[model samples]
Target: MNENKIPEKYTYIILTFTLISIISCIILNAFLFYGFMASIIFSIYLCRKSGFSIIELFNMIKRGLYECKSLFILMALIGAMIPIWMSSGVVPTMLYYGLKYMKGTNFLFSAFILTSVVSIFMGTAFGTISSVGIALLALSKIFGIPNYILLGAIVSGAFIADKSSPISNLFNLTLETVKIAYKEAITSMLKTLLPTCFISASVYYFIGKKYSVVIENSNINNFMYAINSNFTVSPLILLLPLSIIIMLFLGIKMLKSVFLALIAGIVVSIVFQREGFNHIINAILNGYNINTNFVQLNTVLVSGGMISMISVLLIIAGAVSLSSIFQETGLIIPVIKRITSKIKSSEELILKTGLISGALTIISDQSVGIILPGKFLINKYKELKVKNCILARTMADTGTIIAPLIPWNVNSLFIFITTGISTISYAPYAVLCYVSPIITFIFAFLHKFQGRKQTKEIQVKNTIK
Candidate 1:
């Protein structure tokens, strides 16, 4: 075996053991802490056996800290905003109108697009799935739509938004990891995502064509009546978060964007809610609690307060820390090198990277698995004269699009927890998740639209120049 590479037998043993540890963590629902500690321990053990020292480990840890500091801060700020935004009724208002709209159209396509928009707004698949996804499941039950199709649409939409959202941690992480400009990353991602989204919407439209369940106008009237009676709904209230998005589009820092949004939320809640400053303060400290006659609307409104986000924030922090340690141990590098060495051509490189990313989302987390491999593979692609846009597009297509299919991944777990749906049942209908990888692979081999010169042509051009 090469000194840098783990022996194949040992690699298998290590992967098996690590997998067992991960499964245990998931079974115990200790995904945040114990899973993190396990990763750290595994990395340290591997490094020690490879003759790395404690001092080197510490240095690597420091480097990881430096690398992830901005992202960590951004995550914290976004977490803080979740509660305030919730309490201010901004998210609820959005959901209320969103659900109202879904009362008419093809529920599958509507669910997908609505959830996609909400997830992009919320900056997380988990948030979108937990809130809107749960509501969609309930609606499916009420309207007699098949749960599998509803679940599939929800998963597809949330992940697509999560992959594309500028505020999303995964999106931010990818931009940073690839050292690409945010606009550049977004632009590159849209090349693949836009087409996939159109195809996904078309598929959903067809899948839902046979079922026409008209929600009684009385039922829709009652829901709307309940929403109007229970809470204050104002379009102006939305401007706060909308401004934050505008800032993001204008290239403002994510932390600043979230911080401003949180402040805006606080101001809006203090001014708009029935209770005065006292209630606002209590809600911020505890969480928003809305008592209403309409049970469904009550469930929708009574979310998002400071305390509500603590659990998620802690989970994210732990997950990011574990990812940091993984980066530090040189384990990821050796693994990356090993994987890339087997690729014989540019097309093989794209396909293998997409496959590896999709596979790792099953074992490891989504963004880490995808972007880590993506960052590693980029240089190899460049050597083959592949365009950077193609690499970025492929990453989004495979990474963002595939997460919900993995039973153990965060997106799938959140959906399962919130909707009480099986990953296996929903996986087949998550059209974008499966289709994106295939599309990327097809483009890579066909070189039909990648916008890059072939390796030989590039070499010849350089020689002539």
Candidate 2:
């Protein structure tokens, strides 16, 4: 038997496993990590039922983990970085100033914008929500803003950069799989991105102002005082964020840039915040905690460290292992062939991709969101003369943005655990999440305009030849 491809017979079992995962995670409100782990167990049971030897199964596990080691390492470092930066006063400083600037209609609007900025830089939705996202959530609470509005704003904002940021792993993966240049892909995507972002933000401005809470000057002063006392706040600390962007400019890879940023935060904490070497280490290994006596201040000003990310890491480890099974079973190749058989037009393929993207994210994780559906449809786009950029855009709209809308997706769970808001509770307010698909399909039909033009140009060029 060819080891690379699983026979068509196994497809039924695979579909069943996915169905169980979806129902458990969605309907029953089970944690994503546990649901994923259960799927891993189901996969192993299938291996055993097939009478596979112990050695073969073990090898599959190793291969899967090997594929995701870099991702896990990035999460670990980010986990450590968050805490180190928090103790170093980076998060507190950002919060202190962000609160000062974000008022009234700008509060929710700023949440979306601020998370967008940080997620673009961090390249992880979870990190953005855990760090600065945490601070913004707290501020919304202080202003007596409704959690639904804040949740929607923060989630929508956090994914903006995660989907499009050059450093984003998912974005990079989409480019590699779709066989498009980053410049070419992003240029095409910007056409859809600009309009959607503007409309989403405009609608949010009203929603934000509607929920805006009036705070007394005394309350603001006390809030600022609590943060200032915990960490030595100043403009100089802004260097940490600036340097990270500079590192990216210097061609330093994101993983290394994150490590360097972590070290920089530690140094700043030691020099300015008076964090001793031991305390810094503790925070990195465990988590950073600062108590400001006031309950609101204490809640907002604390969090970070490597251990904080362990649960989500486990979920990814489980998800990646299952992804490997799908690969080794050789299901992907046949799956793609079958999908390509029925799709006759670019419009049909694009619309189907948009639908599959959300379903994949719900059944699997963010990576699976793109890998499963995109790979299935990749070659079809080429045959139909659809720009690969259209494929990438569809994936971003459905897969990337939909992650936080489902409680079972790792990204959404991370946000919920960090901010204590359920995905269902805030999904309506997450205008961008739902709005993206609308714009994506609208442009999908409009794409025929550009497609016709390109096709005509190609035909003329071929006639000349």
Candidate 3:
């Protein structure tokens, strides 16, 4: 207690306690939010033991929640937008066109590509998987493709912009933590991501071919008809989703775009879908539900509303509180400091940074993961003459996408709860998520891991050649 430094003994006790708590939660099939809440209580007790007063604990938790306020706002807005869009026919209409165009063997491949685009505009992997990703899986189910492959494709694509989109909070958090320019950070990540995207596309293409099935025109008609009877489908409602993309590209912030889209969806739902004010109000509060002759279509078509985000909000709150306590107690610092001391070569540095950063990532939010690593390692990177951009990119390569692989992590938990795909089954096919670290590691070995714009570009070009 006198050290105020979180001595080695306390460190082991905290680590052991956290590990056991998480493992016990997993074995019990507990909701991850509960685990986070438990972790927070444990941290509070630890903080009190380590010379913190009740007032100080309250302030620390408040400060942590304040940092996460923007994310909390964006998530609530997203929750509001989902049901509005669904009732407006925005979602079903998109699915109709997607199915119409991306027919047969191309559907699975298209699902992968489309989810990437949707994830960027949606600005969260959870939103992409819950809305459009659900539709894609329904389409694949109708076509008789194995759920595992299509589910894998959906999860993989949903993560495409978890760390690169102009409007993504995770992307912003990474840049802020690494102290890099948005343009530069995006450019660096794209360099590593683009190759993986191309490779994953090819992989999905081949795999899709093996299981592709053709639906008769009648089946397509029935699909559209089911949606039509439930919600009025229109091309005009399409503008809402498209505006989100345009607004993001124009440098408008994500929440503003979400507001714009939400209003648009409301207007369309009222006018075209013949929705009453009460119906729209219900949609905003409770979400949209549509019933159809087919149970599968029923599952896919029903979604959205502000209320659905309650559990997610709770998880975020708990995660942030847990992260705040870690920051306050100096618990994470000693572990990171120890890792920093072991760095020898640039490759090991990059590899270990990725591994350590990734391991920490699943246990916390993206902000906490990158902030801790960047705090502990940026100076070392400077000593090694590596660019800070490489540090940012390496963090994403290891830490960013792997969140969805950890079944207990919030990202994976939301994906599993929404999509019903077990993490273990879909992880192997989340090609880009796993491929990214491998790509970064290869870049490290080739000595192409600098953030220097020109030199790193030249090295990467040569390595690619």
Which is the winner by lDDT between candidate 1 and candidate 3? 3
Estimate, for each residue in 351-458, the C-alpha lDDT of model 2 and write its tens digit: 878877776676566777787767767777878777788899899887888888876666765665455577788888888888888999888787767778988999
Best by TM-score: 3
Q: Which portions of model 2 miss their true places by more than 4 Å?
A: 1-9, 25-34, 47-54, 121-127, 213-218, 332-339, 372-376, 417-422, 448-465
Whole-model lDDT per candidate: 0.66, 0.74, 0.76
Candidate 1's residue-wise lDDT over 311-360, tens digit each? 54444455555555454443455656677896767788778777667656
Query: Clashing pairs in model 3?
Result: none
lDDT against true structure, model 2: 0.74
Worst 10 residues of 3 by lDDT: 1-10
User: What's the candidate order when arranged by decreasing lDDT?
Assistant: 3, 2, 1
**TM per candidate:** 0.76, 0.85, 0.87
